[model samples]
Target chain A: MDIAIIFDNIGIYLEGLQTTAWLVSLSLLLGLVLAIPLAVLRTAKSYAVQAPIRAYIYFFRGTPLLVQMFIVYYGFGQFEVIKTSFVWPLFREAWFCALFTFTLNTGAYTTEILRGAIEATPHGEIEAAKAAGMSRLLMLRRIVLPSAFRRALPQYSNEIIFMLHGSSLASVITLVDITGAARIINSRFYSPYEAFLTAAVFYMTLTFMIVFLVKQLEKRWFAHLQPQKTS
Target chain B: MINLHGYGPSILEGTFLTIAVSLAALALSMLLGILGALGKLSGSLSLRLAAQTYTTIIRGIPDLVLMLLVFFGGQVFINQVAPLLGYEDYIDINPFIAGVSTIGFIFGAYMTETFRGAILAVPRGQIEAAYAYGMRRDQMFRRILMPQMIRHAIPGFGNNWLVLVKTTALVSIIGLDDMVRKASLAAGATRLPFTFYLVVAFNYLVITSISVYLLRWLETRYSAGVIRA
Candidate 1:
């Protein structure tokens, strides 16, 4: 039990923790940004407009992230044209490759969640907004998106936690995140238990915090949905 | 440009291993699911706490971390125990067992929630009716509860199984010769990661789509009695 090594190496682990946080935050922000338009396209009335987005979502959601990462990192490198393209700079680095894959993967799941929330928005609300002479864009900005966001908060939080968990896969692609750090330390010390247990503890604490915050948000947003206590 | 001319045999072998791993893990997950669900629903406080703790901890941790921990830590633990138990040779855990057990352990947490929810959704009236007819507890569970719970659980179980199938890809990191690992090797050897991974993705889609249809058929069969004439 190399317990002392873990305790003394808190500073080293903190750097890994910071990398993990950055990876999760960047991927989630990008994923959410990409998801909105995709979700809107999914709900579009025309089959021609909807088909590509549907395929994107199905491909991303259907496959594992590890495979996706390998394809993006190694697959793109196989193309001489891609290497010479303007986009090669972004795809050249492991971190960017990871970020790109995570964003796309979470984008698929988030699109589904946001689409469900948007569709679930009451028809009456939109009718009222239109009757009030609101423009289509204004109606979307003022009425549709706000309500959809509120409705989607709980499930979106689950997506966030899942993305955080999924980001651990990036370690396999050579990104030095939390799991990667554990692997490096485990190799150095030949002590898998201590290194992995520390990483597990870090993940659990983050998950607990996310769940707690999401619960608080749910209470604030859905207070009206709670049943009244009888005297 | 990408080519996949020479990767057929290796990819096929890997696909077989992936299927075997997924099926083994699925079986183990179902067993754990039933047991964990029963533990949560049991009268004993200790059993309930144990189940809750297992699910919560597994759910909270990342699957990759858990997989690595179990794979490497398991080897270490086994070697230590082997020496203590009078075994002289250091026994290494096989990658397949490690992969399946890790996936099973992680997904067993998910399956517990799915199965437990399905069980609770079974009506109280049905159980009471069974009791009224003087059915023993075992008889009631086997004949009355299990069948109905499976009916309600098939959809959720199907989703979990699909995800588990995809998750077998993670075992590749631990040197398992599953499809993803084989694809990785093929990509390295052939310099055609794109073609091979796209093939792998399509393969997953085919399997998941077939299973989705099968689950739908099972759902329809189970609900036949309740369908309106």
Candidate 2:
């Protein structure tokens, strides 16, 4: 009911918003860049090539994001070797640990999504690519990957939103994302509704924005499959 | 199994508690889902809108945020309303109850969508045929609709269950003595965070793997009479 307190802390929320935006966007971008190759290898003919990737995906998908984050953030520091390693500097920071976990988590999911799309590439399309006498790499880069990306669009959008929401967990590690910002305000004023509700509103707005953008992308990407507009 | 240093029994108890929480929440979610599905598919416009708003808000917000909101906000709201009802004793909202309700309430929105789609998937002609045979509404729903909806619902329901199992970890933040909290406590005491958390992660993996195997078997059982291209 006390809305004025939220307005007074708007600057803190904005800072939190910035942290969330960058965390989600950077991880998503890096995850996608990493996933494309892993997905290709996932659909390979050899079981040896596929088994490791499958294990990676299963581990990430099976565990909770919070547990994964903790494993990276708090768990890794338990080892003397990791503590002595050069990567210790980065591993010690909560922000790096969160981003690293989110990237791997999203990467595993995107790999699976893209693997399905790749496997589902129409029979005739591959035949046509083969007929063109293109190299295996050429056929994949030009034919399989583009269409698979299109097919993966809807699911990718959902993943993006999931990551956005998942980013809220960063608050638990002491990074002041939107949820962290709300927790701060709540402790200060003991006004849970004003604090968390404001955070919820921010999240909802961001979610709708992502949904809108994805809808536009879908429309453009699927234009060829859409019915013809006749005069 | 990593040496637990005497925390094994506590972790085992926490595992059971986690399972209990998820199952309780699952039952609550299923009830709300059926009602919300019926509400969304009902003739009343207000009912449909209410169902829509429920799903939308739940889908948008993070589960942790919602958990905090309900835990803290519910405490303040209940104490304020207690005076009017002649209950003067201070009631601290139990974290277990708060966690269960928040998770159940959130997943209910997902289940609503699943159940709604499942209901729609049941053939219209079959319903009409049941009507023609002069069956009562309740009888027709039981005999004709329920079976078909279950077949369609299994996949979505399975996905929801897997996610819900993992989501029980959030209850630990609300101070519910779940496995995650137990592991963290053991980790702190032993100063071996990796060993404990890795065990916790494997615990989750085992649960999900078993659930997947069972879900596949259920899917096959339900689709026994049907053929796919």
Candidate 3:
């Protein structure tokens, strides 16, 4: 139980932490940017618009993120056309591949989460906005999206934690994330418990912080939804 | 470009293995889930705390880390312990057992939450009515609790099963030679990573599609008497 090994390679762990942070935040940011529109379109009255979005979400949510990562990292390399294309440079890097996979995976899940919240938005709220002569776009911007986002906040927070954990797969593709760092330490020093358990501690700490932040956001944003105090 | 070139059969075999591993893990997790839900609901303070800690820690950590820890670290622990019991060799933890148990243990936390919520969802009035009928514990559980709980639980259970089936792909990381791993082996041999991975992904799609329908039917069947909003 040489506890010094973890502290010995503190810089490597920090680099891994940076990679993990970069992957999770970028992917989550891109995922939300894409998911909001897809979710809105997913609830459209027309079948033509809804069907393709549904398929995209289903395909992504149905498969494992690891397999999706492989498809981007290794599978894309199999094609000569892709290698010759301008995107070849992006596909060649493991970080880009990982970011692409996580972004799409998280997007698929967030679409569903947001879609559920949007559909559950009180009909009376939308009705009152319509009766007030608000335009469709204005009503969506003011009444629908805001409330839907608040409702989706709790579940979406869990999704962020999940993305944080799933970013560990970046290690598999040689991206040197936190889990990747642990793998390096394990192979070098023959200490799985210390290597992986230390990584687990970092991850658990991140999870707690994310949960706390989400809770606070909910507290401030959701005050009106709470029961009112009587005088 | 689209051909498996003799690796097709092996990939199919791996697909079967993947399904077997998922089912085995599902069984183990459900057993652990029931016990965990019971522990959480138990009157004993220690039992509730133990169950609470287990769920929190397991849920907090990533599945990959736990898989690696249980497989590699567990192997090291067993190797150290076995020599004291007169075993002379390094114990190679079977990846199949490692994968199933790791996924089982990880998903058991999820199932615990699902089961606990389901158990709580069963209205108290129904239980009181069962008691008023002078039914025994087993009779009450079978007739009243289990059926109603199943109704509340099916959707969550279905979601977990879908995720569990996908999680089977992670078994390949531990060298379980499941479908995803078989695809990898084929890709390595033929230099056609795209086709092999696409095949496995399609296989997953088919499995999940069928599962969605079957689980939907189960939900409908169980909700025969359930009045819906």
Candidate 4:
């Protein structure tokens, strides 16, 4: 409706978008890095190796991300010992707290997705790789990890979208992401519908882009499932 | 320092409100889910488009943003329209109603997708067979489609329920005295943030674990006829 006002505030919105992108991208990368080894430990034979990973995943997955963020940001701030610790500088900023929580939360879910994919890898494929005289590490690097990555991509894409949406919660902890920017604008202008709708559009566009990219990746990976073309 | 002095009544009161809000939201979400699913699956183009748009937009926006938007915007909208209807005094929307409706609307979008998928997974031939047997549309839906759909929908519905339950915590940001809000208050008052939040987390885990077990029981019961002995 207020086209001129929206265009006038484009710079502010773009800054918000940049922050949103940074939050999602950094969290996702860190989460994936943490998830891979955890997934391996989860499906490993030793109970001692697997137990902690299982507990970590369960605790993070079970609790709401908001509570986790608050505990990390506000709860930790309450303790005198934590304030004086070396980690105090890191925990002092809202951004670090948000990234920490997002990393843990996404790590838990990603580990589960990766574990399922790894377990779903067919036994015959692994056996065949071994028969070809490939080393255990080589087999895992080549055959197992590739297949598991492909298998996990679809669900992992959903996780990415979810994490993107969840990052908005970081706005609560004083991070000026898109949602926070929208809140600021709404409070200033008393036109919440306009501000919120604009913010929603930015989010929707990002989601649509992710969906498109995921579909392209799926088609590339599952090319064998496609009907063959007659020359 | 963490002693429960006057906090006993306040925490109890907050728990009661939390349960009340969750149940009311769940009921409203179910109603919206059914209607949205039907609309999406219907033959009419406009209805399908409308339902699709509703689910997409709601699902894209975070619940926190949506909740805030609805609370603040709804208050202003109500005030604007109230004077025209001859209501003089400013009518403030109850925080409970605002929280419930906002969460319900968001979850309803998710439930729409779940229900739609389940409905589509129902074998079409069975519905055709029922029609051939001179069964009316409603009768066919009641006898053939509904039971099978519910069986398929239970798992997804369970997931939605868990997520919806956790989302109730977001209402605390809007000043609703739900469990999380009460916990924050107690933490501030007693300077025992870790203890109070841990208690809050434990309460959630207890509620969630129990509901999950109950849901599994319902799933097994509904699916009993399908499983071969």
Whole-model lDDT per candidate:
0.91, 0.95, 0.93, 0.88
lDDT of 1 by residue, A1-231 (tens): 889878877766788899899999999999999998888778889999899999998899888898888889988988999999999999989999999999999999999999999899899999999999999789888999888998899899989899989999988888888898899889989999999999999999999999999889888888886688789
- Residue-level lDDT of model 2, residues A1-231, one tens digit each, is 899999999999999999999999999999999899999999999999999999999999999999999999999998899999999999999999999999999999999999999999999999999999999999999999999999999899999999999999999999999999999999999999999999999999999999999988888879887778898
- TM agreement with the true structure for every prediction: 0.97, 0.98, 0.96, 0.95
Q: Which candidate number would show the highest DockQ if scored against the true structure?
A: 2
**CAPRI class of candidate 3:** high
Candidates ranked, most accurate by TM-score first: 2, 1, 3, 4
DockQ of each: 0.86, 0.91, 0.84, 0.69
Interface RMSD of 4: 1.1
RMSD, one per candidate, in order: 1.6, 1.1, 1.6, 2.0
lDDT of 3 by residue, A1-231 (tens): 667999998788899999999889999999999999999999999999999999899889989999999998999988889999999999999999999999999999999999999999998999999999999899999999999999999899989999998998888899899899999998989899999999999899999999999888887999888678888
**Which stretches in model 2 have alpha-carbon errors above 4 Å?**
none
Model 3 misses residue A19 by how many Å?
Answer: 0.9
Per-residue accuracy of model 1 over B1-229 as CA lDDT, tens digit each: 4357778888889988999999999999999999999999999999999999999999899999999999999999999999888999978889999999999988899899999999999999999999999999999999999988988898899999999999999999999999998898888887788889988887888888888899999999887777576
lDDT of 3 by residue, B1-229 (tens): 5578999899999999999999999999999898899899989999999999999999788899999999889988899999999999877999999999999998898999999999999999999999999999889989999989998899999999999999899899999989999999999999999889999999999999999999999999999987879
True contacts kept of 4: 0.54
TM-score of 2: 0.98
Question: Alpha-carbon error at B124 in model 2, in Å?
Answer: 0.4
Off by over 4 Å in 1: A229-231, B1-3
lDDT score of model 3? 0.93
Model 4's CAPRI class? Answer: medium
Q: On lDDT, who's better, 2 or 4?
A: 2
Candidate 4, clashing residue pairs? Answer: none
- Rank the models by DockQ, top first: 2, 1, 3, 4
Better of 2 and 3 by DockQ: 2
RMSD of 4: 2.0
